[model samples]
Target: MRARTWRRIPPAARRLLAAASAVAAMALLAACGSDGDSASGGTAAVEPVTVGLASGGSRQDGSWTQAWYEGSQTAQAELGDTVKVTFVDETNSVDAYDKSAASFLSGGGDTWIFATAEVPQLVDKFAKQFPDSMVCGVEAPRESYAANICTLLPRFEQGTFLAGFLAGSMSETGHVGVVGAFDFPILTAELEGFVLGARYANPDIKISRTYIQSFSDPAKGRAAALAQMSQGADILFSGVDQATQGIYQAARTAPGTYVIPQYFDSWEQAPDVVLTSVIYNLQGVSQEMIRLAASGELANQHYEFDLKNDGVGKLAPFHELDSQVSDDVKSRLAEVEAQVISGEILVPGPDVLGTTGAGSKLDLATIKAE
Candidate 1:
């Protein structure tokens, strides 16, 4: 599978939007028909390539799973008729992941896309069970996984740092809030980075964090956002997945409040309220993995996509706030990008900060959030 030029469209954001329903509908039974010629131009037939993704959630969920599903679509298009993409949704649960992978592999689908963190838990077991199959985990670094099970994720904190900078710079109240779902190490990294950048921009920046624990509970997310807002937060960053939409809903009632979205370019969600988003190239990452898998070189690799590799996208365009952002701010963000890529700036992650806490179950200032 390879990537190509394609029009960028707004995401379906899980239950938050209806447009994504079609993406899931089309994907559930999506089949790629060959154009009768190999992309390689060989007179011989192209070998059949089947890629299966045991997604943790529905493709409609606008964040993690949607990115994987989009990759499937790209692979289908780029790989042409020689490839068939199969999807098994609702793989969040360990039982579901085990059962779904078993079912997909039993049907002779060997190359698999493990889009859930739970999939890593099944990697060694599944690799032994299926032996010849490749299990690729998303959402974290898989560099430490078993040889047969690989992983890939972006340095999400790099982008989160930029968001925090923008939030801190633009906040009239010098206070911002982050509404996060379940706390993963990556989420912790994002939180820590956000505060780091905010403080760099405004040393007096006060940070508040609220965790709702569940990724699907909008009411809880709204409550969390409101809690932070009541404490005087003017800028909000969401670390939660689809449930983050609820924070957007909460922001709607608060006039002059700004929002920063992650994972996707969600400007269409709130063009006026958005500061910008920390974007990811999910399609690109998926395509590269498939390409490697097709060539039998995907094992024992921990792939990371970030600002330097174009695997991660920087701050999205500030649509309605175009004029509001000073040119100086833009230039500083570019400098941050350069410094991060050049290793001149080392963003402190949870590993460096040494914290194992998360969600409402953990301590608030564990990550040095003020």
Candidate 2:
């Protein structure tokens, strides 16, 4: 996942990449591998395809990394031994990350899916070095790439809107907390939409925002969640990947606190404390992308996902918290969903970050110290 790809993009430009389709694909090669193509109509030896999954953290990270793990598992299950999958975890170092991916490709892996955000920076290198192999970053930026490389981005702000609405409606302290691994463009969009959605339900909602600057430090996630709870946040969002486990711990210890998981369905982590989750349907995306590749059309065109697009961005099952979310709140959420799909609600992205709700800023000033 390229969590913070567009950090330098101006806020307005960020808006373009946020609330809309967000995925812009610039395909550079003529369609190859089409069924119509054959070597003089003679049958050639077919090379079997193998998928290699690489991540910066362990599968226990419970969010970004785990989501990709599940996606690959689903793909493997669907392929049923036709496609081989090799998984490598804990490759955060740039050199190690590069070597792992290259090793996979050199070891008969013809296709790759990278889970680390920074891995995409070397994508051009990978495409040039291993032209025969195509590479994809799970959540990557919008930049033109070789016909062998494609970046898929999800409009996550849509799901955060519904989560924010739930937080606002269920909060007992009128305060909600957002804790993230990094303040990347996508995460900024999530924060913006969260504030917008929360305030949409309760105009007086106060939000506390924090960025831990690391994706795998559980200690940081725990401390951040506790800090937010101490500041009167009854509903919190764990935007960190592996660190999210610590976030759930904080919410569990608190008497009446709720947490929202990111990138995957994490309600099973804390059945009662976790009210709902913003699920990124990467499993479905992986299946679709694989099909496209098999059909000779995987490269060039970028894939965009949001709630309105093939269930890319979605809310997980209500689980046991259906009663916790009142009928009015659920009804309002349904109505908001329609509005978001129709563009009636302009949930701010990174561009409109500082000021999101009723002229209030999504700054640390709102967080209480007590």
Q: How many backbone clashes does candidate 1 have?
A: 4
Candidate 1 residue pairs that clash: 14-60, 14-62, 34-81, 207-370
Assess candidate 2 and give its TM-score to the true structure: 0.76
The digit string of per-residue lDDT tens for model 1 on 186-293 reads 667677677677776787778898778877788998888888898999999887777777888888888878888787788887687777888777767777777677
RMSD of 2: 16.5
Please tell me which predicted candidate would have the highest TM-score against the true structure: 1
Candidate 1, 146: how far from true, in Å? 3.5
Give the distance in Å from residue 70's predicted Cα in candidate 1 to where it truly belongs.
1.7
C-alpha RMSD for every candidate: 15.0, 16.5
Candidate 1 least-lDDT 10 residues: 1-10
- On lDDT, the candidate that comes out on top is 2
